[model samples]
Structures are given as structure tokens and as C-alpha cells.
Target: MATYEEVKDIPNHPEKYLVDVRNASELKETGVLPSSINIPLPDLERALNMPDDLFTKAYGRDKPAIDAVLIFSCKAGGRAARAANLASTLGFVNAKAYKGSWTEWEEKQSQNI
Candidate 1:
């Protein structure tokens, strides 16, 4: 699993992609993580498989390379885990799920704990 600190350091690591598997509506309800790009779980596979230009246009970021670091996060942790697994199966050598996800992130950010 990806740690909260690792996810938080995304800005310093352009090579890593912080992917939020939550749907658009969820992101609207709960603020998205900084530097994260939403690819809703359902569209993840297609997005990953699509051409680089298409992926870039759709996500405003280049699609991650086969061996790039893919950190997945969701409302809690379930979907994130699934996302990481899917990415790994599709040849992403460094895919990982943030077990704490948004819940832990929100808690930590809110209380500054």
C-alpha cells in the first residue's frame, strides 16, 4: 500500500501518477487529492490502454508508462486496492493502493494531526 506521505509527495515526483479511481460525483462531494487525476474505476482500463495523445487530452497529463509508479486512491480503500491490482495485471510494475485513501487523508488534513 502507498503511504499518505508518499501520495503527498507527488508534486515533487513527476514520474509518479496519483490516480483517483472514484467517480466524478464522489470527487465533487469530497475534494480530490492534490495532483491526482480522476479516471473513474470503470474507465481505468481503457484509459491506460488508450493512445498517449488521447490519454493526455482526456486527463490533461501524459498516460503513465508501463513501468511508472501508479498510486491509486479512493473514498476509503477497497476500490483503490482493486485499481492497483488491475494496473499491476496490465503490466504496471509499481502500482500500489493507498489504504488510508481519502478518509485518512481528510482526517489528517483537517486536524493537522
Candidate 2:
């Protein structure tokens, strides 16, 4: 588990994994990480096919494996942490929870249009 603030600086994987569990309305009301891809928890059971190029470019292919460090974040971290844990049970070795989530993001002075 990693605090939301901590992951801000760490680079993602070549095929970076960012799962935003917030609902459509919450997503509209609140913003997301600049490079994050939304994968609502309910929909996680389905296949995941994010744009390879986009993820690769944002997160270098040098260090963490493609499937490692799957960052999970939601409204306030509760749901996200659960999701991350579940992902781990399903074989995602590097699943992590961003505890600070959107509520914290909004609180940050850096978050703005």
C-alpha cells in the first residue's frame, strides 16, 4: 500500500496501470490524475485494454514490469484499497492502494483546471 501523495512522484510502468474506481458522476464532479485511466471497480471483472502507446510513453519501460504497481485510487481510498487487494488476490502481484484518493487530490493546492 502507498499513500496517494507518495505515488505522485514515482513513474509508472511502460504499460502504466492506473485504476480510478469513482463513478461517472464523481469523475465529472472531480478530476483525475493527468494520465490516469478510469476503470470503475464494478467493471474491473471485464478485460482491460488501455492504449499501449499512451501508457508506455508516460511510464518508461525501464524498471517496473508492465503488470506491476497497478495503482488503485477512488473517492477517498476505501474502495480503491479494496480493489487493489482484490486485484492482488486475482494475481496482480503489484496492486497498490492510493490512500489519499480524489478527496485529497482536491485538497491539494496543485489541483485545478
Candidate 3:
């Protein structure tokens, strides 16, 4: 799993995949990381298998390479961890959860301001 400090650098690294596994309503209420992809936890597996063109059209980003550095985040950490586990089990070699997830992200952002 990634620490808060590590996750903070993800937005600047376009080559990495940052997935927000939170639902639509949570995303609407809390916003999201600037370059993160929003794939609800329930849809993650299907989305990952989508054709490149279809995935890009739906998510506004290309599907990540199997070996890509994939970081998953949610409101807390449970869901993100689960999603990361699922991705790993499905053969994504570098999938991991953001240990602090959204709660830590929000806290850090507030501190920054």
C-alpha cells in the first residue's frame, strides 16, 4: 500500500494509474484528484477489461498497462484495499491501495491551504 506522501505525488505522474473507487455520489460531494479515474468499486473488474477505445471513451483516459502502477483510493481505506486486492488477484502486478485514502487526502489538502 502507498502512504499519503507517496499518493500526493501521483497526480504529477501521468504514467501511473490513480483510481478512485468511490461511488458517483461521493465523487460529486467530495470532488476527486485531478487526474484520477473514477471507476466505482463494483465496476472495476469490468472496466479494466473493457476495450481500449471503449474504456477511454467512458473514463476519459486510456486503460492502464497490466504492469502499470495502479493506486486505488476510497472514502476511507477499506474499499480501496479491497479493490487493490481484486486487481492484484486479476493479474495487475502493481496494484495497491492508498493507505490513507480520501480521508487523508482531504486532511492534507486542507493543511496545505
Candidate 4:
């Protein structure tokens, strides 16, 4: 899995995908990445099983392509790692977890809020 710092250096590419696995409340408590797919982990199962048309309806038609780099993040590393593993098993080629997550992000930035 790539560290947030490492990914930060990657040039902005529309092909890269950032998936935030945090729930709505957690996202509210800790801000999300500027451009990220906000798909809570608990809802992963249904989304995975969604029919092609339904998938577009639920996850949006712009859901990142499977070939794109899938970076998953949560409050801590635990959930993000699990989500990454699941994505890998499901055929996401470049699935990765942001091990530091939001806690580390806030700490590294020294953001009080």
C-alpha cells in the first residue's frame, strides 16, 4: 500500500481513483480528500453485487474503472486495509490502502480541528 505522502507526489491523473471507505459521520468528523469516492465499507457488499445499470445508479455512472489505481482510506488503517484486500480479490488491479488514514493525516498536518 502506498503512503499518503507517496500518493501525494503522484501527478494529478484523472485515471487514478481515491475511494474513501469512511462512513458519513466519520467523514463529517474528519474531512475527506478533495476528490474521493465516498463509499462506506458497510455498503460495499450491495454495491459489489449491483447490476451494471444499478451500479451506475448507486455508485454513479462515473465510478472509476477497474484498471484505475484504487486507493482506499478510512478513519484508521484497519478498515481501509480490509477494503483494499477485498478490492484486490475482486479484480481491482491496483488496489491499495492508505495505511495512515485520517487520524495520521490530521496529526501530520497538526490540524487542531
Candidate 5:
């Protein structure tokens, strides 16, 4: 699992991917993490399977390498953990879930203010 601090520092490492597994509507209701990309849980498998050029065209970012560092997060974390598991099964070597997810992120952001 990724720590809150690790998720918060994504901007410093361009090679790492911080993916928010929430749906578009959910993201609209609650803003996403700073550097996260949205590939809703339902569509994740297809997106990951797409060819590199197609993946980039669809998501506007390069497809992650098999050994890329992927950090997943969702509403309260369940989906995020599942996402990590799915990625692992698909041969991704360094997938992780942010256990606290957006709920913790929101709570922690409030604490900082």
C-alpha cells in the first residue's frame, strides 16, 4: 500500500503512475489527487491491455511498462486494492494500493488546513 506522503509526492517522480480508480462522476463529485489519472475500475482491464500508441492516444500518457511503479486509489480503498491485484495478475510488477484512498486524503487535507 502507498502511504499518504507517497501519494502526495507523485509530482516529484514523473515515472510513477498514480491512478485513481474512481469513475468520472465520482471524480467530479470529489476532486482527484494531484497527479492521478482516471481509468475507472470497470475500464481498467481494457485500458491496460491496449497497445502502447492506442493507450497513449486514449489516456494522453504513455502506457506504463511492465515494471512501472503504479499506485492505485479509489473511494475508500477496496477498489484500489482490487485494482492492484488485477494489475499484478496482468504482469505488472510494482502495483500498490493506497489503503486510505480519497477518504483519507480528504480527511488529511482538511487536517492540514
Candidate 6:
């Protein structure tokens, strides 16, 4: 798993896949990471397996490879960790949770601003 500080560098790397596991309502209330995609936890697996063209059409990005460095985040760490575990079980080799998740991200962003 990665810490919030570690995740801060992810946006600079185009090959990484950062995913937000929060519900749409939560995302609507709180902004998301600039490079992250929203694939609510419930739809994660299906979204990951979508055809390349379909996935791109839906998410505006190509689907991540099974061995891609995938980082999952949520409001806190719970759901993110769960999503990471699920991704691993589904054969995603490098899925990891953002240890401090969205809460930490928000805190850090506020500090920067």
C-alpha cells in the first residue's frame, strides 16, 4: 500500500492508474484527484474487464493492464484497502491502497493552498 505522500507523485506518471472507489454522491460533494478515475467499488471488476474501446468510451482512458500500478482511494482507507484486495484477487498484480485515502489527500491539498 502507498501513503498519501507517496501517492502525491502518481499524477506525474502517465503509466499509473489511480482510481477512486467512492460513490458518485461523495465525489460530487468532494473533488477527486486530477488524474484519478471514478469506478465506484461495486462496479470496479466489471469496469476493469471492459473492452478497450468500451472502457475508453466510458472512462476516457484506456483500461489498465493487469500488471499496471493501480492505486485505489476512498473517503478514508477502509474502502480503498478493500478495493485493492479485490483487485489483487482478480489478478491485478500491482493494486495498492492509498493508506490515508481521500481524507489525507484533502488535508494535504488544503495545506498546499
Error of 6 at 109 (Å): 1.7
List where candidate 1 sits over 4 angstroms from the true fold. Answer: none
When 4 and 5 are scored with TM-score, the better candidate is 5
Clashes of each: 0, 0, 0, 0, 0, 0
Per residue, candidate 2 scores C-alpha lDDT tens digits across 10-92 of: 45433656678777778988777656667678866442333556444543432334367778889889999988877877777
Off by over 4 Å in 3: none
lDDT of 6 by residue, 3-111 (tens): 7766888778889988999999999999888789999999998988789899999999888888999999999999999999999998999999998998999998999
- The best-first sequence of candidates by lDDT reads 5, 1, 3, 6, 4, 2
Candidate 3: pairs in clash: none
User: Local error of candidate 4 at 73, Å?
Assistant: 0.2
Model 4: lDDT equals 0.76
Candidate 5: stretches off by over 4 Å: none
Against the unseen true structure, what C-alpha lDDT does each candidate score?
0.95, 0.68, 0.91, 0.76, 0.96, 0.90
How accurate locally is residue 22 in candidate 5, as Cα lDDT from 0 to 100? 97
Model 2 lDDT vs. the true structure? 0.68
True-vs-predicted CA distance for residue 72, candidate 2, Å: 0.4
Highest lDDT scorer: 5
Q: Please report the TM-score between candidate 5 and the true structure.
A: 0.98
By descending TM-score, how would the candidates be arranged? 5, 1, 3, 6, 4, 2
State the lDDT of candidate 1 residue by residue for 19-107, as single tens digits.
Answer: 99999999999999999999999999999999999999999989899989999999999999999999999999999999999999999
Highest TM-score against the true fold, candidate: 5
Q: In candidate 5, what are the lDDT values of residues 4-97, reduced to their tens digit? A: 9999999999999999999999999999899899999999999999999999998889999999999999999999999999999999999999
lDDT of residue 26 for candidate 5: 97
Off by over 4 Å in 6: none
